[model samples]
Target: MLRLAPWKVASILAVTFLAVLLLVPSFLGTATVDRLEKLLPSFLPVRPIVLGLDLQGGASLLWEVDSAALTHAQVETLRDDVRGKLREGRISLSGGIAVLPRGVQVRIADAAERAKALPLLRALDQPISNAIIGTAGHMLDITDVGDGSVQLLLTDAAINDKIRRAVTQSIEVLNRRLNESGTKEVNIQQQGVDRILVEVPGLQDTTEVKKLVGATANLEFRLVADPGDPPNEVDNLPQQQGGQIPVQKRVMVAGEDLTNAQTGFDQNSQPDVNFTFNLRGGQRFGQVTSENVQRRFAIVLDGKVISAPVIQTPITGGRGQITGNFTVQEADNLSVLLRAGALPAKLTVVEERTVGPGLGQDSIDAGKRAAIVGGVLVVCYMLATYGIFGVFADVALAVHILFIFASMALIGATLTLPGIAGVVFTIGMAVDSNVLIYERIREEAHMGRSIISALDAGFKRAFATIIDSNVTMFVAAVILYLFGSGPVRGFAVSLGLGILTSVVTAVTMTRMMIALWYRYKRPTKLPI
Candidate 1:
């Protein structure tokens, strides 16, 4: 019990030394870490903990999804489908086919033909079931408004489900956009039914994020109707020139099938974005170009025609490039948007918060001060209570802290304000573990057990209790991480990891240190 195996001694020391080394980068700034990264070999691990939005002061934005536009678009699509289905069914109507406020309105001038048209239009209604066991509904509610005019509005359940899906898709799109922009440690989560909360750490100017997230970069390839075609005749996209060009409403190839997009310099040294399509997209593009070789195809991005070049030849390879009046940054941004895909609905920034660097620094300083004070008080109390054994425990406590920071850096965790609180809270937890072992030792020694026997009995007796307490706390931390978001998740991460590392250092590392001390000194009495 007094002697540690040679392997055990080496393992404990090696871990402690490595932990100390890992913590150096966390304390140092980015320049120092960057220098070390360049100077050292790739084999050497040298990563710092990424600070979160609360600790480092970045941008926080709350965006609302535009569900109205989604409904309008869906209804427009339904109008086209109804037009096709009615025409195919040889059903004739008298008044006019127009989109009403509630839904598509088809007025039949002939009252006798109204009965025949109603049954055909009712076929447009689709089943809507949000839950597996719940009652399903139709996508459209077809009803006669008045005088043979049938109105079709989206069902309530379907609209609610669409809004939920739109919010979810907006979050996913924002995440991909931030990642593609070389931003790290971003938190994007759905706040409510229609809102998304985004927190980006270490970003000062949120203009780029806002632009990327807000830009409805919905790309589509549409056949040009004619240069003289009016806006009312077809879907018109504004050109870089003064006038607008009418284009076919039907999409030739969607941006969703674009597998990759990269910024590259054109042959004339102008910045352009090259995009590649997947198999289905490639086939569609090939067919479209082959069928309309001499016609001009418009590359429409966000309802604007960026380019309208003649299809000189069939592009069967699925590779194409967009050449426009674009700067390097604009080309790169477009590539990012194209690669990340488009959001499901437009996003409106309903709320925004930007944290300054000075504030973040102040928070970091306050956290440091609290940790120092707490650590000092803990060390002082431990030493005052059990003398040399307390000193050993204090040493273990420091090592435990080092392990926490080291693990966090290793996993690239974002250290937020709540995470710092978790670390501070862990300082006390470390002291508690030592107190448990020390008090158990004192109780054993008072029972008249020999010093060596008492020390061994103390650790063995307290093992189960220590395990139970740490396990329960660890489980709670896991629950926090699973259910929470942003700062709460950061706190959970630090706390959970701190508990595991503290337990190891508290029990195993402290035991090893005591065993080494006993082996060297041959002590007659235990310090506790």
Candidate 2:
């Protein structure tokens, strides 16, 4: 152990230097770090440690997917599809399609028409992709209603699948919206079957964030129905200006086809949202406008008609503007939502809490005190117990802490309150390895061995025990990270990182320090 290679020594010094460099920004002010980042090399890290919501103060919002609204949407869509299919097949229905609680039902008095309509209706049943079971089930269950009616009900598997999709899509949409709004370190994840937990760090006021996240932004364009149009084909949707407007239920274009949306001013210099569509939507839009010139089309957003304007000429440019009584902020937010696309389903806020910066600062101060006290005590104990050997361990322990923060900064890990606890706990753990080695060395020296032989034997023999203990602890950290959520996972991350750095500092670095000391001092007696 005393015969340390030149390359190993150089490598150790290089790593220590790099760790210091990596941790530099964490201790500096944000403005200073920002300036440094601009001046520094692109490959070098200048980003500061990201604090968690608990540490930096922000909002924690728990949202629940509106299963009732989701079911209503599905049933409504199914009803429309059934109507379209019956019309496409030229099959006559005995009555209007009946909307059931879980599905839609249609009666066909003619046996021949029922047989013809059955194939077209069955074609609407979508196949679900299940990872474990492969192509497992269909989205719809088609049942014969004994008499002349056929029922199309949503399957349990389909409902579950829709909920999962809604959660996933909501997360993606929220991420895009919040990130675009310059909210940093926004943590969004699925909490349960139908709930989402969103943590926005550094933003105490969550009103805007909540508004941005909750808005469904489901934009649709439909032709204003003529007075003579059938009641079943027209829907009297509420208008933003007050009262209701009769519009055709068939959507001319939807938000899904929109490629881009931006806040702009209309010809009247009023705040509006300008949108551009994709190839398919543009063609369909142009066709609708060309055929229905002089007729009005309603721009509907989240079921409310924002505007209903007469189409004086064909809109073949694939671009349009939505004029509404909107403020600049509203227009901007609307454009953002449109650009992000609509949520799969409505999300209701079930729980919400905001952490103020004052509380966060208090927690930070408490954590700092704990870490400082723990580190100082450990340092003092080591020095008083082992003399010069203790100094070496103390230096290594400092480097170990540096390595922990450096690793965290490199990986952009957020530090939380529990993470601070983990760091303090690791401070004691950092010195434990040194204590074991020092005790082992004392035993060897008492056995009549030379100082060099004792030191070498101590590290070599105690190595296996150190590895075994640290390995088990590291495994525990891994399990905690895998199973735990929020702050618990933060604790696991710090603990895991501390274990790794401690192993390096406690074992190899300390051994190297002792080896170098002995090489120069040529000590006849041990320091301990």
Candidate 3:
């Protein structure tokens, strides 16, 4: 057990050097790190653990998806499609269709047309799944509801499917919007049904985040339906900064055609969102502008008119600017939204909170104090118990701290206040395996074994107990991490990483040190 090969020596040296190497830069100031980053090669490892919202200070926003609104929109679209289908089939109905519970009630003018209408309505029924995990089924059912009346209603599964899709799509869009803002360390995830959670670390102001995430960003270009129509003539007019603006129902250019959007100053140094279009959008935009020379075209976003300029010449370059009389920040936000595309459904803030830097500093300072107090006590206890061997254990404990932080940085784990507490808690536990081994060695020494035999037997006997206990705790940590969120998740991650590092330093490093000491001095008696 005291034997050490050259390769084994090299391996141990390499691990110690790496642990110290990864940890050194973390102690340096940010300016020093930046200078070194410029000077160093690309392959050198120098990353810090990302701080959580509690440590870094940021915005926490809880949003509830308007799924009921999605259902209403779906019903309206279905109603329009059904009406169009009936008109195309030349089916006559008196006073149109009445929307009823679970279906549309169409009262036919003639009883003879009822049979014809039933088949037509059935033809419009969409294919959908009936069961949650079953095969495809029909979305609607056309039933005869008394004399000359046919009802077409959507299936429960289809309505539910729409709701689920809306929630998922909203989350995805939120992620894209935040990502477009060039923001990092942002967490956006689904909370419960129809709810989303967004936490942005290092964000002091919530205004930009709220604006970017909440903006529908639904952009469309359409011609003026009636340039002379009075302002009060429109009911479905889009709401804008001034009021509702009337635009053609037919969309000339779609936002989906947009490839990029960036904030830029206009010729007059006014802030504006400059946008580019893809190949398809460019063609359509060129055709529309060329055909409608001297006619007004409106650039609309989220039902608000952005610009309504009369076409003087064809714009074939596939690029344009949206002038909304916006502030610089507003223009930047609009550009971010335009680049991120549109959310499939609307989102409303259910809860919001802002974490200031003062609170975050307090958390960080408290965490530091806890870690220092816990570490110093552990070191003192180990030193007092086993003397020289306890010194060895303390050294291993320090290495465990290095390994834990390095692992966190390497794995990109977020560190919260609870996570710091976890690390500090592990400080007390770091010397556990060594304590067991030393106790076992003491037992062997009391049994009259030689120094080498006692050391060998101690490590061999203690390893099993160490492995079993660490593995059990590791499993619990995994379960906690998988089930928990936010601070709980941070705690689980720190605890889990600390467990592995502690096991390594205790069982491996302490054993190596004792073996080296035994081989070099050739002692007859052990220190413990």
Candidate 4:
């Protein structure tokens, strides 16, 4: 029919080159692997498929904020604020307490004090919007108290809102930390306002992860007396060594002025943590050190003192180091925590499940089995029905898979069981375009056209139909991707990519093959 064109030969070569460039490096573990993995996808292939947490086996945590406790705490804070204000105003009252859901309430002790208390009470009575309020004569009552004291109630809506915000913030912080930790494919989501789900696939040290999650990273720098220093008063000094000794009090700085922190080894080959401060922090640290040379400053992290070093002189460079007993890993983790900043809300572990790598291996084995069985069956059916054309279709289909895998490896998209299934389905659906074109060719050949003429007519007539069908499916896949989450999106992605690749291979590659065959054999009669 048609001879293989130079452009088709070039295309095949290009695809082969791309497949090797994109996919072959994924099997390599050398120094160039990372560089290759990043560069291959842009010029060569589609995004890579990453394995999901379930397949890789790491840690999944479902955590719910104690909304009731949060509400109670908020109300208590409000109550304390009111109490402090009242005490400052020198007002005396019998009962004025803030409870969850309902705001604060203040009962006037005497009728004479009504005027004084009303304004204060009214000022403090910032209505918890959406809370039911009851008024009986001079008494104001807040109804809907979900938990805690009956002074003010924290509403369900308020708790839900806070939980949502907390979850969002927590995810942001966790992402930052995970990125710094060099972990990939971390999944974090809000199950509800109060609950968060975190999945870290391929993470081994759950204990370390738990530590990072639980840490608040509220760093502080305070002046502490060196245990080896002399007492403030000579008579008050303990003669013994390593006793609590009072060194001159000095304030060098705090971590609030810190802009960044990193882990490094000191000149003496000991583990140390280093931090850089902003202008403000630099200025403060400079002033404090200048004023109190030889005084010790303690670097505190999450309420524990990590190091206390004496100021020998004013450090104007705005950089300092903390030396302590630390392993290389601990130092690195500390640096990561400091750099990632702090979490908005404390993450409490409500549920946790861990999967071992062995299980993940089993899952991979099972997925491979399913894929092989399904693929072989599809190939057999396609070849049986379409004969030589079907075999051509099969070759194109295999190329599609290679391209898909190459794309996935290039992009680092995690592969899951669902994702594997998506790929398998893609293979089965990839033959549709070939089938359409082959059927059209058969019809044209039956109409008594020459082999070459019939092949051309078939491709020309079937192109539009192939486009229309694939376009419709592509649109549906887009919709599915838009509405779907997690695994559903994986399926959409695979199907969408498959459709595009199938069209190209079926119309373009199949035509090239037919041309090459016809040119070689010079077949006067139709193969159909």
Q: What overall lDDT goes with each candidate model? A: 0.83, 0.87, 0.79, 0.69
Candidate structures ordered by lDDT, highest first: 2, 1, 3, 4
- Model 2: per-residue Cα lDDT over 1-528, one tens digit each: 468999999999999999888888888987899799789854567877777777776788999999888888889999999999999999998989999988999999999999998999999999999888897678999988868999999998888888888899988898778655321446789998999988877656689988998788999999999999999999999999899999999998987999999988877778888999999999999999999999998999999999999999999999999999898779989998999987888888999998655355766888888889888888998889899999999999999988988888887777777888988888788799988899999999999998889999999888888889899999999998777666778889899999999999999899999999999999989989
How would you encode candidate 3's per-residue C-alpha lDDT over 70-188 as one tens digit per residue? Answer: 77777787788779878877988877778765557778868767677767777887676535666566778778878777777888767777877887887767766774322144677
Residue-level lDDT of model 1, residues 1-528, one tens digit each, is 545789988999998888889888978888899899889864567888777766666788899888889888887888888788778777787655798654788877677777777787888887876666565666888888887788888887778788988888777777677754221458788887889988788766789888988887789999999766665668867996558887888888999889999988888888899999999999999999999999999999888888999999999999999999888778978988898888888889898888654345766888889888988999999899888888899999988888998988776677777888899898888778888988898899999998788789888998899899999999999998777766787789889988998889889988998877877888888776
Runs of candidate 3 exceeding 4 Å displacement: 28-45, 59-73, 76-107, 115-165, 168-197, 203-354, 357-364
User: What would the per-residue lDDT of candidate 4 be over residues 1-528, giving only the tens digit for each residue?
Assistant: 355669778978698678766776656654566576466542344333445666766787887766656566666676786687667667776665524354465554555554564455446444334224432122134332322222434444555555666677877788777644221456777786578787776655578778878877766666665466566522222212223433333334656678888888888777778989899998887777787688766666665666667878888788888776887667877877877888766778988887654346767898889999988998898889877777888888888888776666654555556667878877776787887888898899888888888889888899999899889989998887667655676667677767777787777878877777777888777655
The stretch of ten residues in a row with the least summed lDDT in candidate 3 is 178-187
TM-score for each model? 0.64, 0.60, 0.59, 0.57
- Going through the candidates in the order shown, the clash numbers are 1, 0, 1, 24
lDDT computed for candidate 4: 0.69
Best by lDDT: 2
